[model samples]
Target: MTIRKATFDETQRILDYALVVLKESTMGFVKPRVEIANLIMAPILADGGYYLIYEKNRTIHGWIGVGTIYDSYSEEVVGTIPEVYVFPAYRGQGVAEKLFHEAFRHLKTENVNKVQLNVFAGNHAKKLYEKIGFHDVSTLMEKDLD
Candidate 1:
């Protein structure tokens, strides 16, 4: 398997995997897949973010998207990973870790001082993050009014 930056032509494939992730993680939300995909891919395509894909034998098995965050108070740039998804068949084979390491390496070259990511509560990937030197710095809480 290899990890590399995604190209424009691979947008559709990335969107397909992103939709699968959204469906698995959210509830009671409805949106046209193409619309959602466009929204997600726009920034990455515009160079405001980074998107990476894991491919094996010419088949894409997973992807990750990360956007840059500028901290006004600290005058520093941070990397925020918004999504990471590996197909079921590719899980447990270190695909996510490889993708993350490659992304982090690229971000470091861009002078990113820190990297952050959000994992759904109880998601097994949380353990992977922890194992890779990520520590809890804050807690995010939300309430559903409807």
Candidate 2:
């Protein structure tokens, strides 16, 4: 598999893959499937954000999105790995590993000291992150009231 920057024409294809993964994992309907496209594209199209897509045999296999976060008070440039997903069929193929290292290279050029992303407490992907050199630096909690 090869990792490369996704062109506009490829954005729509990635969006479909993202939505299918999320819907399968969440077990709920996407409010508006189209929003997944926005979620996948918004940052990459933004001023200092990017999307790196992984492809094999001309077919998209996975993607990762990143952006720079400016802490207004400190004006620091912190990189964030906002999203990453691989089709279930593509898992364990090392697409993420390839994509992540490339994104790291991108962050380094931007002077990012650290890159961050949140994985649910028990997510298997957390292991992937750790294996890739990310540590548990913080915890995220939430309460659902219905």
Candidate 3:
């Protein structure tokens, strides 16, 4: 398998994968998957961000979206990994790990000091992220109103 930056022409395909990830990972806290996917992808496609695809024999198996963002609390620029997904059949084969590391290497080139990503509670990928050296820095608590 090989990993590479996705082209602008490929944004919609990547967004399709992103929608699946959001649906599975959001735990219903977010709504309207299509709009959310577009919002997350627009900045990356416009500039200052990247979308990477993992493929084997020219067939895509997974993708990741990353970029740099200013963190007001930290008062420094931080690398943001906003989306990561590997097809169900491709899971457990290290695709996600490779995607993350590749994203990290790219971010380092941009001179970012640290990287951060959000994970919803009960998402199994949280364990994998921890294994990859990500630690909890803060929690986002929410309340549902009727």
Q: Per-model C-alpha lDDT, please? A: 0.76, 0.74, 0.85
Q: What is the C-alpha lDDT profile of model 1 across 1-146, one tens digit per residue?
A: 78888886785567666666766543324353756756655665566785799999999888888678765656787887777888889889888888888889988888887988766676667889999878887777778999
In model 2, the runs with Cα more than 4 Å from the true position are 24-44, 71-75, 144-146
Q: Which lDDT tens digits does candidate 2 get at residues 9-110? A: 776666656655555534453443757746644764576576799888988888888787765545786888767888778989898888899999988987
Tens-digit lDDT string for candidate 3 (1-146): 88999887776677766667778877666774677878876775566787889999988888889888788998999999888888899999999999999999999888887999999888889998999999999998878796
Clashing residue pairs found in predicted model 1? none
Clashing residue pairs found in predicted model 3: none
Which of the numbered candidates is closest to the native, going by highest TM-score?
Answer: 3
**C-alpha lDDT (0 to 100) for residue 21 of candidate 2:** 56
Measured by TM-score, how close is model 2 to the native structure?
A: 0.78
Highest lDDT, which number?
Answer: 3
TM-score of predicted model 1? 0.80
The worst-scoring run of ten residues by lDDT in candidate 1 lies at 23-32
Candidate 3, residue 124: Cα displacement in angstroms equals 0.6
